[model samples]
Target: MKKVLVVILVAFIILQFFPIDKTNPAPTPGMDFLTIKKTPPETAEMIRTSCYDCHSNETAYPWYSNFAPASWFLKNHINEGRKHLNFSTFATYEPKRQLHKLEECIEMVGKKEMPLESYFVGHQDAKLTDEQRKLLIDYFKREKAETERKMSF
Candidate 1:
């Protein structure tokens, strides 16, 4: 038992040196969704708190993000989240894809599937009130309508 414990401790210590890269690339103005859409201040704040960490290029990493196993997990989740929907690169997506993603965003928020429960566990502020959810859903609907209107013309 003593030898096993020693090995585990050594492994934990060694793993700390194998840190995952958490540095975010510089944000480009053209890449921002807000630049193209009318994002209300309150709604923007909610998104910043709840979604930006994973969904945007400007991820404000927590201190624990520098720690070993947690760092690896955070890096992986962030990468996956960005792959699915990167608000930072919203303009880069094709119009059809953007429309689809916006719809999905509304559905996820409406169903309370966003900000992932695990994320809210550490970030209480990320939890959305019913009103916030409605606001987000409305925002997505408006954006979708505008996009469709523009495409029709």
Candidate 2:
């Protein structure tokens, strides 16, 4: 037991040397989601607090993210999240994909599947109230309508 504990402690210490880079480049105003779509202030704030870490280029990494295995997990999760939805590059998505993504966003939030369960544990602030969830659902509804309207032209 003592030898096992000692080995674990040593491994933990050694793993700390390999840290993942979670740093994001400075945000440009033109590259923001609000710049492309009309995001109400409150809704925008909610998205920033709850969704941006994984869904955008900006990820506010926590202290534990510096630990080796944890850092790797964080990096992979962020990468996968970005692949699914990158709001930082929202304007670049083709219209069809954009529309589909918006629909998925609404569905995810309505089901409370977003800000994934693992994320909310560490980030209490990311937890949304019922009102916030409604606001997000309404916002997406409006956006989807607007997108469809434009496509009909």
Each candidate's number of clashing pairs is: 0, 0
lDDT string for model 1 (1-153, tens) is 999999999999998999888789789878788776868888888888999999999998888887889999999999999999999999999888989999999899999999799997779999999998998899988999888888787
lDDT of each: 0.89, 0.88
TM-score of each: 0.96, 0.93
Across residues 1-116, which tens digit of lDDT does each residue of candidate 2 receive?
99999999999989888878777866766767767896878889999999999999888888778788988998999999999998898888877888898999999999999979
List where candidate 2 sits over 4 angstroms from the true fold.
Answer: none
